[model samples]
Target: MSEPIRVVVTGAAGQIAYSLLYIIANGEVFGKDQKLVLTLLDIPPMMGVLEGVVMELHDCAFPLLTEVIPTADPAVAFKDVSAAFLVGAMPRREGMERKDLLSANVKIFKVQGEALNNHAKKDVKVLVVGNPANTNALICSHFAPSIPKENFTAMTRLDQNRARAQIAQRLGTDISNVKNLIIWGNHSATQYPDAANGTANGKPVTDLVEASYLQSDFVTTVQKRGAAVIAARKMSSAMSAAKAAADHIRDWWHGTESGRFVSMGVVSDGSYGIPKDIVFSFPVEIKNKQWKIVQGLKLDSFARSKLDITTKELLEEKEEAMAVCNGN
Candidate 1:
């Protein structure tokens, strides 16, 4: 059997991590036969709560899970880790300004990033899932100077999955049939759920559904689905967020289908004219442990207009996050 690799999860006592840890231990994110040790992190005061969560993981008796280590020290939790999930962040309270929220989380991510850079292997894949994730990832990457920028990602797979589900339901087809639905730009509502290249069972979505719905309703629905869930459930999305995080990591590790793209927020190389140095979600696929942007998709004028809006917002977010990180 291959030696076990260590995987780190922040916010170990939080709702999303509660849903995600079981999936990881069950070999959903990492495959069966690969052994794993879960390194979990939370605040010192939350250690008691984290101990109970660890007990539940042990109760499952997953053969592949060799150990569960919970710690409040960032250095101890991140040491020698292969992959890390930055899931904990300051949630926006009622009446909190966007700048204030960004500033608060920037402080948290900076410390985590430094710890990872100092302790984890240089090749660790870092996925940032907290709100304003793209910018949070950018700030984290900035602090983790030893790790390559390309290894840092923000979760936009949730948006991609939501778009695919909406398309599949509208067409009354299985979700498996939808491929490569583009989520251009930030993960927020400004994201463009472009069905321009996606297909339903090898048929172009345009051929299956009305262009009006794809252009207007489909885009808006995928963008606002998060808020709609909160309204209906009285809580922000937990299960779906956890599921998407699983899909994001699984696809990134296992590879996507041939001739298909998925949305991931990776560092910009000026693709699609998005500004360089900011982490922006683009259509991409992973191969040989690396993710490269999908190239050569032509955008119509309407698509370009929406991309402009989101990219502008991301650039603004980048400015705010960087300022906080630099203590400007």
Candidate 2:
């Protein structure tokens, strides 16, 4: 067997990590043949909770899971890891403003970024699953100067999965039939769930679904699905979020199929008129653990307007996050 792959998950005691850890341990993200050393990180007060999580991991007796290291230290958690899920961040309180939430998360990500730069392996793949994730990813990448920008990404996969599911539901087809659906810009309400170029089982999705529904309900529904879940369950989404995170890392670690693309929030290189350096969601193809943004998809006026709104929102978010990160 090859050397064990070191994987780290922050917020290990949280519900999302509860679901995510088992998935990783069972070799759902990485291959079943590959051995893994799992590091579970949380706050000092949550160390007790993390211990329980570690116990559960051991109880699972996964053949691929070689070791479990639970700690509160980012330095310890990040050390020489090949893959990292940055799932920990301050949650938005009932009365907190968006700026306040961004400020809190920026502080957390900045420290993690420094830890990644100092302790993690040079080739570590970092996924920021925390809220304000796109901007948080940008902040994390900012402080991790030694790590390549391409190594860091934010989770827009959940948004992509939601969009695809809605498309499948509308067409009365299996979710597997939805292809090339992408979430553009931020992972927030302003995101564009572009189905214009998508297909359902090789048939054009737009041709199957009414444009009126796509223009109204379909777009709005996916954008606000998280809120709806919270409203219905009295808590935020956990299972679906964890599953999407798993699919994301799995696809990235392996590769996407030919002519198939998925949404990932990556640092922009000015593709499709999006401003450079912002972590924006774009349709991308993955191979060799690298993502290339899909290009030349014609965006009509409506799509362009939707993209601009989300782009503007992300720019505003970046401004706020950077100010807090710089201690302004």
The lDDT leader among the candidates is: 2
Per-residue lDDT over 1-328 for candidate 1, one digit per residue giving the tens place of the 0 to 100 score: 5799999999889999999999999998989988999999999989999999999999999999999999999999999999888898898899999899999988889999999999999989899999889988998899999899998999999999999999989888899999989898898999999998989999998889898998999999999999999999999998999998888888888888779888999999999888899888999978877888999998999999999999999999988888887784
Which regions of candidate 1 are displaced past 4 Å? none
Residues 15-90, model 2: lDDT tens digits: 9999999899998999988899999889999988888898999999999999999998999999999999999999
Estimate the TM-score for candidate 1. Answer: 0.98
RMSD of each: 0.9, 0.9
lDDT of 2 at 279: 98
Give the worst 10-residue stretch by lDDT in candidate 1: 319-328
**Candidate 1 deviates by what RMSD?**
0.9
Per-residue error (Å), model 1, residue 8: 0.4
Clashes of 2: 0
